[model samples]
Structure formats: C-alpha cells, structure tokens
Target: MKFLLLSILISVAAAKISTIKVTGTVLCRKQKQPGLEVVLKESDSFTPDDKLSQTTTNKDGFFEISGQDDEWGSIEPYVYIFHHCRILKEGCRTRSRYDVPQPVINGVYEMSYIDLDIAQSGETYEC
Candidate 1:
C-alpha cells in the first residue's frame, strides 16, 4: 500500500502544466458592450469545471484573460461570457461558452469579436 501511494503521488506531481491566454471583444446591437463578465475555465471529465480567470469587459468591450493548470493530459480551455445583451428582465443575463481550439493551446487564442446580439447555440439564461 505504501509503494502504491508513493507511485500515485509521484505521478500526480509529474502532471504537465499548461497555460493559455484569451482575448475578445463583445458587441451588442452592433455596438461595443462594456461591463460584461468574461471567465476562462478548464473543462474536466470527472470533476466540476475549473475557473482559470475572470474579468469584465472594458469600456471598449474588449477583454483579456489568461490561466494555467496542471493535468495528466492537455487542459481543455474555454471562455464563458455573461452579459445582459438582449434580455429585458432586471438582474437577468445570458451565459455563453466558447471552447478554445486545440491548435491554440499553450498560446494566445484570439476570439476576435463576439456579437452578443446574436444568440449562440448552447447559451443559457441566468440571474
């Protein structure tokens, strides 16, 4: 049992560390949408998704977030945007998730421009 525990500990310690940076701009009704929340996260198979970084869009509706994680395999990175782009209800917003492509791992992933006025496939409403 001791030997097995030692091996497991060593393997966990040897997990690979990966880093990613993401940048994007948000637009609502063809105008820059400021103050929207943006989050960088890592998707996990057996556990809750990990939040890497979080920030709000600037006055220009531009946001930049970066994160790092250690895992047995490559980290699956994504971005979640929370905004009140189209909803009229007070204190309600929509959350959208965008997965980073594998080719952009370990480097900067430019999302270009995201227009919140256009609905996404898997977006959800939140309060």
Candidate 2:
C-alpha cells in the first residue's frame, strides 16, 4: 500500500510539469498587424515568479510562445498584446482569461488563431 501511494504521487508530480504551447495572430483594422509583442502568463498567479514567455508577430502577424509549468490547467492561461491601439492609455491590451485545452489523451492543445484587432472595438486590444 505504501509503494502504491508513492507511485501515484510520482505520476502526479510528472503530470504537473507539462509544457504549454499557444499560437495566434494579430490584426488591426482588418489587416495583419506586424511588429507587435505577444506574451503568455499564468492566469491565476497574481504575482507569479514565472518568467514570461513572449514572441513578436511576424510579417503576417502570427506569433507562438510556449513554456513549462505543472500548474497549467489549474491556474489557467492568458495572453497579452502590446500594440499602438492603446498608445494613449496603456501599452498592452489583455484578453479574457482562458484555459488551455487538453488534446486527445494528451495535455497539450492546438488553439485556433486569435485575432487582436483594434478596429473591432476601438477600445483596448479586444480579441
């Protein structure tokens, strides 16, 4: 019984260190907006010490960022976009919190393209 419990604990520990990968695009005014900074952060970590993972949008306004953490689904995940749309107010526009979807029998997910277009709302970076 003690050995079984130890084995279960080890399996749970291993599951928590999985990596997260998310990809999306940036669009402003119905066009691909390039040269923007995109970032991913832990949704529940108000003061998370984890290093932020970020990437710049390509010529086509696409970006991909990934990181490893055991707190994936429990903490949730969010993306931040830094663009000129909020030049007067703030440097970044944050989207609503979302959970990383789990793939078939796996912990990783391939998300659909999320568009950060300013023309749609003209407020902040609304995806």
Candidate 3:
C-alpha cells in the first residue's frame, strides 16, 4: 500500500502543467495601434480575478501573452484588446474577446494573426 501510494503521488507530480502562449494584433481606425494594452484571462467569467497575463502591442500592433495555469483545462482563456476606436472608420468590440485554444502540455500556442479591431457600434459584427 505504501509503494502504491508513492507511485500515485509521483504520477501526480509529473502531470503536465499548462502554459498558454498567445500572439496577435490590435488595429484601430484601420491603423496599427502601438503601446495598446492586451490582456489574457478566463473567458465568460466575472470573478474579478486578475488577468493571467498582460502585454502591450508592439510598434506594428502585434503582441504576445504567455502564462502558466495550475492545471490544464482549468480555465477557458481569451484575449482582450482595449482601444479607442473611431466611429465609421473601423468596426470593433469594446472589450473584445478571442478564444485561445486549449493548449497541449508545455506547448506553444501561436495565435499569429488575431485582429482585435474596434468598430463603429455594437450593432456591427457582434464580436
């Protein structure tokens, strides 16, 4: 019984932890937004929890967010891009949400081309 319990503990210790890697872009008024904030968190949640990670877009409006969760599949992650969007220039969502796929163990999830674009109103594109 002692040996069996030890083996189980070892297996649990070796279980893979999940770390999410996300990369994407932010566009506003049809232009790349540098220094804009990009946030990663649990999607569809209102727990007042802190974000898993936060980053700023690069000069070309690109960003990367990476962080580790205690366990795999514990959180449904999403990206948020907050920008000041001009009306009629580019259609967008204010607290834009983009799904980050469930990651493989210790894997890199390269979300290379997500465009978090701001829009004219909530009526368009229902993002």
Candidate 4:
C-alpha cells in the first residue's frame, strides 16, 4: 500500500552511506604477483556479505580499490585476496580476508607490501 511504500522509502533514505578506500601491493616469493583477485566487501550479521568492488592486481602487483554501502550504522568493511601462492593443487587458490580497523573506517586504509609466500592466518584454499 501507499503507507507501506512511504515507510520503506523513509527508512532507505535515512540509512547512512559510508565509503572506504584501500590500496596495497602483493608479492609471491619476493616477486610481483599480478592477476590476483581482490575484493572489497561489507560484512553483514544476518546475511551474506555484500561485495562492493573487485579488481585484479596490476602488472606491478599494486591495487587500489574503493567502495561504499548504505547501512543503518557504520558499514564493516574488509578485503579479500585470492592468490595462487604456494599451492600445489590445480585450479585452486588461497583466500585471505583482512578486516579494516575501526580507526581507519572512513579513511584510506593502506596495507603495505603483503608477501603471499608466507601463509596468512585464517586463510583457506578454494577452487
């Protein structure tokens, strides 16, 4: 009905839009890792995390990505990196997630050089 639609519109308009920027470099065995997938996501408690943006690392193994989402409160942002470092299996990659710190929520979060040769905590293998 009209009343229900109005309420929904109001709630949607009231949600706050938050944006985040992230940049980093990836290295595998001390060499630049290109064509690695990087994703920016907004974590959700009751549903699947929303993917805001995704990109592959450049030839220099550098990536810069930004995204925004609307939420009732501040959006919880994180980065996922998929790479084929130290993997013996075929058609599989290692996935790693890095949560953006609260202090750098609204600002640019810079992850300096990340060496994929070293295993990251909580990383998983995915096909």
- As a TM-score, model 1 comes out at 0.93
Cα lDDT tens digits, model 3, 6-116, are 998887776554667777666665677798778877543545644789999999988888876553235566666666554344555355566666653245556655444
Off by over 4 Å in 2: 1-15, 45-49, 72-75, 86-113, 118-127
Give the alpha carbon lDDT tens digit for every residue of 36-87 in model 4.
Answer: 9999999999999999999999999999999999998899999999998999
lDDT of each: 0.92, 0.60, 0.64, 0.92
Query: What would the TM-scores of all predictions be?
Result: 0.93, 0.58, 0.61, 0.88
How far off is residue 39 in model 4, in Å? 0.8
Q: Is candidate 2 or candidate 4 better by lDDT?
A: 4
Clashing pairs in 4: none
Clashing pairs in 1: none
What is the lDDT, from 0 to 100, of the residue 57 in candidate 4?
Answer: 97
Candidate 1 residue 83 C-alpha distance from true site, Å: 0.5
lDDT of 4: 0.92
Put down candidate 2 lDDT per residue, 31-123, tens digits, no spaces: 787887777666445565454487888998888878765653443555666666434455445443334554511244444555444333323
